[model samples]
Target: DTAALMKTPLKKGDTWYLVDSRWFKQWKKYVGFDSWDKYQMGDQNVYPGPVDNSGLLKGGDSQSLKEHLIDELDYILVPTEGWNKLVSWYGLLENQEPIARKVPNAIEKEMRKLFSIPDEKEIRLWNKYMSNTFEPLNKPDSTIQDAGLYQGQVLVIEQKNEDGTWPRGPSTNKLTLTLQ
Candidate 1:
């Protein structure tokens, strides 16, 4: 009977009384039904059943009952922060495993295509930008001296930030840059 009831197709607006024994007890306690007979009589005042759309569950018609059931199930009502944390935590764990183990080579190939590295010109431009923006905090053996020209566009390197990770003392003499 319970399985048949679950299989029953519920329309947009259909009134349903609490007949399930488990739900009946909960409903009786929730509404404070004094007598079991009164609760079973399908009384409107004590146990109202109205075909309404305002409070229906995802697949049922009755907001209050649906909410009660969801609460009873200890369902996790996820907020934006919870969802973000879940995604971030999953990402951290997922990165620990190699992709080749989880997906087929076809998927790996597609991912490789999607994240293909840029050409030499793009790298030069990026290097130039890095040099101009960051002031070298320390002197370095090597400097971004020049960016070659490509497609008639000249690439110029500029001083950016001093490499903070330099092994020696704070030289405040090195320059970093990138070309466009």
Candidate 2:
């Protein structure tokens, strides 16, 4: 009869517990979660990659018009150092002849619309997925489609590295872009 007197009524999804000083830490466990500010700190890269129409993948706050150009133009040639590696690594390798095959030079208008090439620097695109080999569409009459580039593929813009060396090799760039 004494034991029955101590029994308490319970409800569904409710727990009955006898907590003490030791339970203080246990109670805090329920609140263990990340806030938006904490989640905001994420990996950032030096260069940008190809972006979607809205530029969500590139991070809306940091999305650059250069990145959007790749998505906008019909056939814009990108330089090796121009595109973001962390962004467009996988898309380029999915198609055959992933190499900068031979897009026609007529895309010059579109390419020019993207950016003006300096006398020293030529607009180029590369596959940094596993390699740093950059191919330049020197001829404006050429289209990158001939360079084995398909829709949604990415090519890095070729440029001088900090050390004044061209990005190269699987060691430096990471993988060889073997074209079929």
Candidate 3:
């Protein structure tokens, strides 16, 4: 019955970007409808029930997360100072999309080079662990070897807010690091 309203028949590889309710109002004007009532009566099919998460999906159903992932750099972690300078250079905001590149095998060495950190000093990667805490990534790190990193991971250097409060360090500070 829904197919009867579509201008074109749904194809085998059809996909759609679902927008939230906040942006849904813009569709009426963009679709050239004079009023909400007219839009409601248009060729597009409407479901009366609430949207279900499992109902609409973009990619192949059989593919695993690893299969869906590309072998490219997914995230970058930079020190706050260095990040500020880099943002100034690009004239952009704090968050930006990454340009695609192959994931490096030697993440420790690569991160040191990117961070301009010394060999003796260990560079720690941090991520949000809970509501207000962040924890350092625990991986094999050394001057001579890789940090055993993989793609799709986002890590950052710890930072303190402007109110003289630490955002994500207390939890990690309490954790004891033991060497085997």
Best by TM-score: 3
**Candidates' TM-scores?**
0.15, 0.25, 0.27
The digit string of per-residue lDDT tens for model 3 on 20-70 reads 232233223334434435555434454222211121223343212222222
Model 3, global lDDT: 0.36
For model 3, name the residue pairs that clash: none
Write the residue-wise lDDT of candidate 2 on 1-180 in tens digits: 212322432222232221121222221232221232233233232112223223212344332222322322322233332222312442321211211222234454455556665546644444433343444444444455434454445555555565666564323324455676
Please report, as a residue range, the 10-residue window in candidate 1 with the lowest summed lDDT.
94-103
95: Cα error in model 1, Å: 48
Question: What value of lDDT does candidate 1 attain over all alpha carbons?
Answer: 0.29
Instruction: Report clashes for each candidate as comma-separated counts.
Output: 24, 33, 0
Q: Which stretches of candidate 3 lie over 4 Å from their true place?
A: 1-103, 129-131, 140-152, 158-180
In candidate 2, stretches whose alpha carbon ends up further than 4 angstroms from where it belongs are 1-113, 122-124, 128-141, 161-163, 167-180
In the range 1-180, model 1's lDDT, one tens digit per residue, is 232343443232332232223333433444445454443454444443221222223343332333333221323222233323333533312112211111112222223344563222111112222335433312121221111112222232222234533332233434443455
- At residue 15, candidate 2 shows an lDDT of 26
